[model samples]
Target: MKKSLIAVNSVAGAALLTLVAGAAILLVLMFSTDGDADADRRAFFGSLMFSTKEQADGSTAITAGVDDPVPLIVLFVVLAIALTFIQLTYRALKVHRQRLLEERGLA
Candidate 1:
């Protein structure tokens, strides 16, 4: 049972790490701007479904529908905290079980 619990925890941790890493990579990509003139400026906006184009002046003429990042950040933080709590709880449970076995002269 303990071995199975450890295996499950390992898999969960790996999956969480993969998700966090992917999100981090995506966030980095979102913030990164390449210094290429030929780079399609419309691509980014198009990905976000933005249809308005910039005028001769230096101001945005169109508003695009987009999801706010604040809520996503908050959700990620909450998930990270929850995963940490689960890991700590698993460790504590394993330790407690070991101590119990020792106390009963089973180990």
Candidate 2:
């Protein structure tokens, strides 16, 4: 039973790793600009608001939540941490079971 669980976990972990790698690649591609080095540098350089526009009367307007990623990336980061904790717990339990079997002389 323990061995089968470990096998299943290994398979699941591998699949998850692959999925994460693919998602990371996709994210990188998504954020990539059109061969503009200055733009790329400026993007991560500051947290300026993007909803501002200059009016013909020499005034500035600012709204909210334009290109905001905190609400989105926070979800991904929390879920990733949850998955890491679960995988670690699964591996720890598998090792504990193996040790128990070993101590019992059950191979």
Candidate 3:
């Protein structure tokens, strides 16, 4: 049972890692400008707003959600901590189960 669970978890983790890597690569590709200043400026400014328009006075007009990356960063940190805790708890439980089986002559 435990071995099967470990195998499943390993597969799932690998899949998730691959998905994240692909997403990161896609993001990099999307944001890469290849020395195009206009595209670089567009990519830099576009990620910050839901809607945007250029004014004749050379100023940005932001519609919503300007500079909102802090919350997203915080969420990722919390998620990483939670996953670490879960993995540690799983490892501890596996060790404890092994100790119990050994004491009871079941393994």
Write one digit per residue (lDDT tens) for candidate 1, span 1-107: 76566556655665676456545544544445343221222222233322334466754454333334444445456665666667768789999999999999999
Better of 1 and 2 by lDDT: 1
Candidate 2 pairs with clashing backbones? none
Best by TM-score: 3
Each model's C-alpha lDDT? Answer: 0.53, 0.51, 0.52
For model 2, residues 1-107, the per-residue Cα lDDT tens digits are 76566556655665566446445544544355343232321122122122344567876554332144453344445555566667778789988999999999997
Off by over 4 Å in 2: 1-67
Tens digit per residue, CA lDDT, model 3, 6-29: 555655665565446445544654
**Candidate 3 segments whose C-alpha is farther than 4 A from its true place:** 1-49, 52-66
- In model 3, the number of clashes is 0
TM agreement with the true structure for every prediction = 0.42, 0.39, 0.43
Summed backbone clashes in each candidate are 0, 0, 0
